[model samples]
Target: MREFDYDLFVIGGGSGGVRAARVAAGETGAKVGLAEESRYGGTCVIRGCVPKKLMVFASEFSGLSEDAGLYGWDVTGGAFDWGRFSTRLNGELDRLEGVYRKLLSASGVDTFDCRATLKDPHTVSLANGEEKTAKHILVATGGRPVRPDMNNADLGMVSDDIFHQETLPKSILIVGGGYIACEFACILHGLGVEVTLYYRGAQILRGFDEEARGLIAESMRERGIDLHIGTNIVEMDCAGSDDSDTGMGGPIQDTGETVGDSGMSHRGRQSGDTSDGPIRVKATNGSSRVFDRVLFATGRRPNTDGMGLEELGVKLGRGGQIEVDAYSQTAVPSIYAIGDVTDRVNLTPVAIREGMAFVETVFKGNPTPVDHALIPSAVFTQPELGTVGMNEEDAREQEEIDVYCTSFRPMQTAFIGKPDRVLMKLIVSKANRKVLGCHIVAPNAGEMIQLAGIAIKMGATKEDFDRTVAVHPTMSEEIVTMRNPVRSA
Candidate 1:
């Protein structure tokens, strides 16, 4: 082997890449070099989740004036300067980038700003034509937004592009059926925009507990969002300027192709430029609508492009994700991948864990497997939805499971006299009574699930949750005090 400059070389300085670099170089005392084409903090920190949620908070306050009046506050119609909010998100992100830099530097890992492309199995070439070699090359370049293949998609935007939008769009048509799509629906709705969310399916979210999905849909409608659950966006027309008929002339798709034994392919997604009152949308049944701005919150594809791993014989799996074993090792012995690049579980924390594990197994010589079974996720809608472990439907479909679920109006709603409702459900194994899943839809449900996740992962049962003392004056108490229960539902 040639004498190399570093022990481990990483491409893409996102959550996983930076973490692995830090642990391997600092803790394991290995010489590590990290190459990043973008910001150090990666997608979740830079453009994906953090800044987007910040925008959500800003947008939500735009309509809060209406609710404040109910609490004996006086206010009139108000306007929000979205440019100002975008600036704030950017400033905060700039500070975050500095912190990531400091953290990586303190770990003694060298950083490269140019793009990295693997030449041979172990050699990497930079964009500026600098060649470097390492014993191991880790591909942690997370995912990127998939813009529609319509005319001037460049004019349209994806979830990542919306973080630092030039200005707030008065009306937005978001496309896709995923958590990001639903989360964006709630965020943009809260932000006081005429937001119309289009999901190709009968519902918005997929892979979530179905009951919670229904609750979210209802909550979004209650919060005044124009949600079209069984619809899609076929094409976006940006010929006019941002101000010219802000909602005019966008095409929709008619997915005439039926779902086969596997699923429907893009070949069946036919396009029709039918207009819907100046906004743009596409229905499965030959329909079209229009909007001011378009957001493809649909999903993300790994940033495995232009970073030459294919020629280097790196393996990739489903959805163009870099292939890795339990410890995140790639097909090539020295190459490994983590985070969205690996696409195992495309969450921020999961990538961080993979990064930590990669160091342990590769550098420390003591391997640790990534446990993804009980990973938790939160959709920060106006009323949040949080879940961990096997959901009721998933548990039932996968294995024989007992369902213990209850939902009721919180005390806040009783006093406020609002039509909002909070639902909580638990799925336990019929064979052993171990808590298989926990789902909640309420204010701060995400935060409540954080503590409950531990108990669920520890194999707690319905009886244990029932026996636990309730904390007064909190919505979380409902989790432990579920009065009604059915054996099987």
Candidate 2:
């Protein structure tokens, strides 16, 4: 008899777990069992990238008519219908979850639809009071959005709650400056909501290239996002919760709208909105205002609580991320992890790559290590920010470098007298003329960066880029045509 019931048992049905389970079972002919407490597709498909990107697309339509009018087309725009868009978005998520299930079944992997915890190094206990033994256990429980720790903070919603909002608020106060906060600030503004963003920092998108993030911040303000730097909410309470005056103004009057079955009243007021009214917020700048909703896109933490990991001697980092080796193996052999749980690279593609590498090392015996260098990523803010490799500041600190950058109004929007501008920048090493980094800020920047990522990954030099012919009349062509370094650092 075999020592364990299965060769491999996976936890969390997110992208990383699903990919590893399917590949191991189908290709290596290993017995695999997988469990998921929530939806199969996890954050990206159900509540994150997929749904959020669709919302971004829906939000962009609020400006299409004006741009079309400039091009001599009489296109009329209508009020955004949140109900109609949300219905279709949920339908797409359902279809995707079904697809994830079908793939696992086709691979002959045993699937359990419940929460799982480690009973021991090689044992898994399911929520249904069942135990499964495997020769190996892979944890890819993923991460979750978290709210800040402050009084009455629970009243605010997180990124996950944004998807389930039955209707868009008339006005929202978003607290943070990360990609999630910035993206939604732009998204809600485009969808016709009054968006006020408060960040307790000098600038937004802190770790990104300074020039790129500066342009994004300027563009957000130009597009009507009331972005305030070095400011944050000092206090917040539901309107009329306290009778004391805020000094700037007295208590806000109730709208007298009856709460609906969805807990929201007339229009897009929140469940927190009572007969007394919406939420009242006091900012660090001592200004007070009322908002229909308050969203906290502060940050995310790995899902590792009560998983029986620490008991088995698995090391967890300060951020609660599982500490794993080059092959994604934990301190205890026979246990592994990947994806957001590891916190190496939080992107979906990075997790998938880590999973495949884990399989290659353990199942295939080829001992492959995860390759995380030169990964390209994008921030889906208005006039999206796409970047690959080091930024100018970091490159300059490490070695002498040349920075080539240009910003100009693109032809399409320029002809219409629109003020939209596109940026193309490259950071090159002075020693070998290697293109150390590339950053683009414009529409579809994410798509352009993927093709550029290939050349950077192959160690393409500045001369190599110069030798390549430019695609005329394209914003990306600036990358190849710029003959001189605008500045050196």
Candidate 3:
């Protein structure tokens, strides 16, 4: 048998890769080598979840100050200092990156700070001109936010760029109606930015429970986000230029090469002047506007380009996601993949679970299949949304379901004369009496759904939820108190 450099070679330093590498090395005592070209903590720790939640907490203060007065506490709202917050956020991220490095090192996994790509089925090539062979290779490259191929799209920023902004814009036009777009729109608005949101779809928060999303949309509007539905940007250019229609000029063509999956070009000039000018924008709705910034929270694609995977007979999807079986094994049995790169669940915790499953299957001589079902998720919109299992629309398509839902003004908000309302909903399977789904739209909904998720995951029945006595005067008590079915399908 030919001797390989290591027992395993893992690519990408994100959650999946690091977890797989460390577990295989520490627990299974596999000779693992992991390589990461950027920060080790990956998207969730470095850019996606942690920093975004901090911003969410910062944004909540504006409402907290108002609610304080209603509760007989004298609290005053103050201006948010993005500079100070961002500085501290960056420092915290740096500390986290260090922790990831330390964990990998202590696990006895050899770490490489350079990009690594597949040279062949068993061979790997690094950016620093190093070549190594492994018995098994894993790819967890993850994904990146993408902008649509519209005119002057480069002038817009993606979700990743939001963290690196030097300062907050006085006003911003946020495009797309997905969770990322809605979350940032709320965060920016809370931080005192004049936020405007545009979505080409009829409504925001698509793919969620209709009733829950409806309440979230109404709450977002009440919070003062200038939301426009069924709309999109057609053209954009720098303000103060008189070149063509809309008094701003034609679309600023992307002359530079595309970078990664983000759909951004390096050579396109910015859409505004250096002296604090707004970017001219023309929307499909025949509306023209000028804004300090245009943020495209449009969508994201898998990060698979230029990685040499396709050349190695690793099947890829239309979105560049790796084609994997239940074990995350690619067509090439020696190769496996997990996390966003596989496009399975696309959640950080799911990615970690997939990674651990991969290690158990490959290293421990035990075949483990990842379970992607009944995973709870939360969207950090102003009111927030927490959901688990099948939504109403999807459930009704396959089986008869009873929807038990309630929407009411909470006692706290009612005391303040606030128009805010919360929603709690349960979708129960009629045949099995099992709680097929649970959705909540309210403050701290994310925290609430976590406990609810445990019960639903265990196949808890509607009677099980009923037997659990309700906690009085709590918003979550509505979850258990909702007995009568509002509708059945």
Q: Which stretches in model 3 have alpha-carbon errors above 4 Å?
A: 245-277
Writing each residue's lDDT as its tens digit, candidate 2 over 1-489 gives 659989999998888889999999999999999988878887788777888899999999999999998888998889999999989998999999899899999999999988899989989999999999999999988877666666666667777778777778899998888888899999999999999998888888888899999999999998999999888887788887754633333222111110000000111223333222378898878898999888877777778888999999999999788999999999999999998888788888888898899899889999999999999888899999999999999999999999999999999888988788888999999999899999999999999999999999999999999999999989899989989989998
lDDT over C-alpha atoms for residue 232 of model 1: 61
On residues 1-489, what C-alpha lDDT tens digit does candidate 3 reach at each position?
A: 989999999988887889999999999999999888777878788878888999999988877887898899998878889999999999999998899899999999998988888989999899999998999999988877766676566667877778888888999998888888889999999999999998888888888888888888899899899999878777787787773643333332211111111111111333231224578888778999999988877766677788799998999998788999999999998999988888878888888899999999999989999998899989999799999998999999999999999999999888889998999999999999999999999999999999999999999999899999999989999899888999999
Number of the top TM-score candidate? 3
What's the TM for model 3? 0.94
TM-score of 2: 0.93
Rank ordering of all candidates by lDDT, starting from the highest: 2, 3, 1
- How close is every model to the real structure, measured as TM-score? 0.89, 0.93, 0.94
Across 265-356, the per-residue lDDT of candidate 1 in tens digits comes to 11111222222223444445476555777766655566676567777677766667788788887778888888777767778888888888
Question: Scored by CA lDDT, what does every candidate get?
Answer: 0.73, 0.85, 0.84
